[model samples]
Target: MHKTRIGRDGPNVSVLALGGASLGGVYQDVSQGEADAVVQAALDAGINLIDVAPYYGLTRAETALGAALKGVPRSDFVLMTKVGRYGDKTWNFSREATLRSLDESRARLGVDYIDVLQCHDIEHGDRRQLIEEALPTLRDLKGQGAIGRIGITGYDLSVLEDVATTEQVDTVMAYCTYSLQDRRLAGVAQRLGRSGVAVFNASPLGMGLLTSKGPPDWHPGHPSVWAAAAEAARRCEALGVDLSFVALQFALQTAAANGIVSTVVGMSKPSNLDRNIEALTTPIDPAVLTAVEAALAPVRDKGWDVLPGGGGKAGK
Candidate 1:
């Protein structure tokens, strides 16, 4: 596991972070034992950042991660979680809700202070509220030692850029925008990095679209995007390789090259840990990568539609 400075002057952290959504069984039902193993595996592999949110399993992930990290030294890892987006259609970025949410997250994670407290899925909340109410409250929390850094997370590249530049967040997390099928995050990440905002590139598999099993029924990708990914997957299968491995490799390699801070991935079971580690260590075959990219060319950078600043329309 390689380590890098988070931002222009932030703390050093692993390039790969463990995403906690799966620990709460967001993708599949996982027992406490399995969740613990996944956390332990990430730590043992030197993956120092663990990202979670109350919305993940409706707070189950924070609780499970707390239990899994009970005996470990708090200094050994960086805890990152989010607030404001609680459900598919629920979002509250008011100052009062922000304060209460942080308290609940702290209690659930069994931590006195978080390393990085983010506004989760900010594009789903009112931009004005996030700026006028939530961000100021977070800054106050940072001043009071409730958190070390402030961050914003979302799927929209433009939203991330808009808030990160106009507001004061130390980090920005963009999902599904840096994978093989979508490279839209590259420009935004570089701009943010130059402006001293660390970028966390997440969902290397595009929320299961690049996996061998394909996207879930709830995935909101357009039909053309689905067809393009399926064709890419078929190409990877023909070459006796898993599409997810290539996708992860692409994300990790590209992030390293593009000044992005870290690449995040989720693991529900311990077995998933080994596979992710393999992605970090293995060298991707260029020929396979080229073929996969070619197959995905039709839908490259075609992000799904979402309302600006999260009003009127809801997107997952």
Candidate 2:
């Protein structure tokens, strides 16, 4: 894996960071053994940056990672975790809650200071606290030596745009906004890059919407999206390839070309890790990618809200 710096002052991390939500099995049931194996595989493959959250299977992923990293030296990897979203559907972005959350994450991951501490899922909460309190709290922790850097993660582009320019944040985790179906992150990409904010993109496969299995029943993909995604998947199958491989190749290479710091992909099984590494090494067929993009035109930027009250359309 290639290396890149997170913001101007953050740690040097692998271009392909391992996302922890899949270890928690947000889309399906993930066995503990499977999670541990993938974590080990990522480390063996020279992956040093791992991103996790308390809400990922309600802390199950952190527990597994802690067990997986037991014998490894702490300085060997850059660990990052999130605060604000605590439960399956609960949030607490207050400073007090954030402090407690950071402590819990450290204990779970067996670390003294997280390399990157991010505010997770910021779209559902009050923007003022996130901007004024939560972000400053991460900075405070940095000052106190509890964290190395600070940032925010969310699916909403507008909320992300606000936090990207907060001046206190050092990184941003954007999902679904920079994928094959959406390039909305480009709207704020230049500004964030110029401001020295490292943007880590997740959901490069669009939460399985671009895969043959389609999205899980709980994913926010709309009905029209399902149709277009199915058409794209069919085209991939005809070309003797999986849509996910194409999706990952397109998204990660594009992000690298665009100068995004890293692309975070989750894998519950170790085999997926190998495939991802291979996808990065091999060149993608542009003809196939162009066909898939054309097939997805109907669903492009249909705009589904991740938060209640239909709030995901801003900054598009």
Candidate 3:
């Protein structure tokens, strides 16, 4: 597996990162043993970066991850997590809360320090306070050896840019806007990646909207969007390819072309992890790409509301 640097000079993270949402069982319940197997699969496959948050399974994900890493050398992997949110669905960016959250994360993960600590979902809070309090608090933690790299993750691109230009975060994570259907981040990702703030492009499946089976009930895509997606899947099926394969590949390839640092994906089962690795290892057929594009042309960029920094708001 290849690697990419976070921001200007942060630690080297694998090109493929394992997102912890599924480990937390966001879509479906995952057993501890199953989660452990998936993590092991990631390590065995040479994947080095693991991103998780308290928001994922409300701390269940971190617990599983920490357990999975119990026997592994700390230096062998890059662990990224977040602070600034409480388990009770409340926002707390105060310095005291920040410290407490970090401590909780450390305790849960059974780690001395987190490699990358970001303010998770900054867009949901008062942007001013998050920028003024949470972000700086992260820097202070970095100074105090509690965290390594500082980062910000959100669905608001403009707010991210606000943090990027004005603050000192080492990386920024944006989701769901750089996939095959939405190239909203195209122009700026290269520039940001060149400038040294690693642009982590995640959510390549757009929360399962791009898959052959379609999204969960809570998804906000218009019904026609699903129809269009189904048509795209049929087109891929005609060519003996899965639409999911095309979606993930297009997301990865798009990230590469835009100079984005990494593409993150999540899976609760080992089978899912193996499938993604195969997708990454295989070359995407240009013919399939063309057909998939044509089939999805009507609904490309159709699902979410775009934010300023190339982040996306789910269509409601």
Candidate 4:
């Protein structure tokens, strides 16, 4: 278990984070006991950060996480959850809504203060409203010690770019654009790093596309994702390094990626978790890194959208 700082100056967190989306039933159904076990396993493994959202399982994930952390000291780990619209659903960041959202999340997670409270999916037209009205309320909550820090999560670099300019935002949990396949977040990372804002690289595995199993084609949003991932895997095979290793290591190895937050790999069983943990521990050779870059060259040349920022969509 390796550790890294959340921001250039924020508190230290595990190099790998535990993404709570799976526990919330994004990929597959999970029992409450099973979700708690997953959280316990992550904690036992020294993972310090657990990120979840109200959008995931419609708040079920937070409830499960709260149950898992009940006996543990609050100071032992960092807990993060998001507020804002999710999917086709609409949510306003009105002061009342902000208060309600935080209260519900806090009550569900059984925490007095959240380690990180992010605005989820700022691409909605109501983003400006969140910044103007909702942010002040969030800051007020921060003043009253309701949350440790305020952050925002989104799939578009441009949205992040807008959020980065705001003074109220302390952290940004940008999506997969920062990974090896999609380097779109390179500029955003550099910019946010200079501004003293912490950046959490979510979807480092491109929603599991970079893994050994590759991306799935069952969802409407995953067509290009699967294609890009398949191409990368083929290239990795040609270059003689495990494709999954390439995907995992590529994101971890980036200099711009200082915190190296959890890549958020989903699992249907404990064995999958074991395999992912094993992959994290495996040392990636320098030669493999170089080869992965070479393997991605064709996709780079083809000019297909590789990152979420550049119109590379995510699966629903």
TM-score of 3: 0.92
Q: What are the per-residue Cα lDDT tens digits for candidate 2 across 1-316?
A: 7888888877788989898888776757888788778888898898999999988888988887887788889878999899998775677789999999988988888888799888887887777887778888888899999898887888887778786775547888888777777777765765788888888888888777778888766566677777788899999999999998988887777786675888899888888899988888779998998999999987677647632222222122
Q: In order, what is each prediction's RMSD in angstroms?
A: 2.5, 3.0, 3.0, 3.5
Sort every candidate by lDDT, greatest first.
Answer: 1, 2, 3, 4
Consecutive 10-residue window with the lowest summed lDDT within model 2: 307-316
Question: Which pairs in model 4 have colliding backbones?
Answer: 17-262
Question: Which wins on TM-score, candidate 2 or candidate 3?
Answer: 2
lDDT of 4 by residue, 1-316 (tens): 7776666566778766788888777778888888877777877878788888888877877887788789888878888887765444566778788888888998989988888888877765486688787778879888888887888877777777787676548888777666666777666766776776777777766666565677654322234555766776776777776677666666655533443344555543566567667767667777766766665654442212332322333322
User: Candidate order by TM-score, highest to lowest?
Assistant: 1, 2, 3, 4
Query: Which segments of candidate 4 are over 4 A away from where they belong?
Result: 211-214, 218-225, 235-242, 255-273, 286-291, 301-316
Candidate 3, residue 170: how far the Cα is off, in Å: 1.0
Candidate 3: tens digits of C-alpha lDDT, residues 163-261: 776785678888876787766666657766766777888888877778888777666556777677788888888888788888888777657778788
Looking at model 3, the pairs that clash are: 7-196, 7-198, 8-196, 157-309, 158-309
**1 or 2, greater by TM-score:** 1
Candidate 1, 116-135: lDDT as tens digits: 99998888789889999999
C-alpha RMSD of candidate 1: 2.5
TM-score of 1: 0.96
- The deviation in Å at residue 204 for candidate 1 is 1.0
TM-score per prediction, in order, is 0.96, 0.93, 0.92, 0.85
Worst 10 residues of 3 by lDDT: 307-316
* Candidate 3 structure lDDT: 0.79
**Model 4 Cα shift for residue 19 (angstroms):** 0.5
How far is 223's C-alpha from truth in model 2 (Å)?
Answer: 1.8
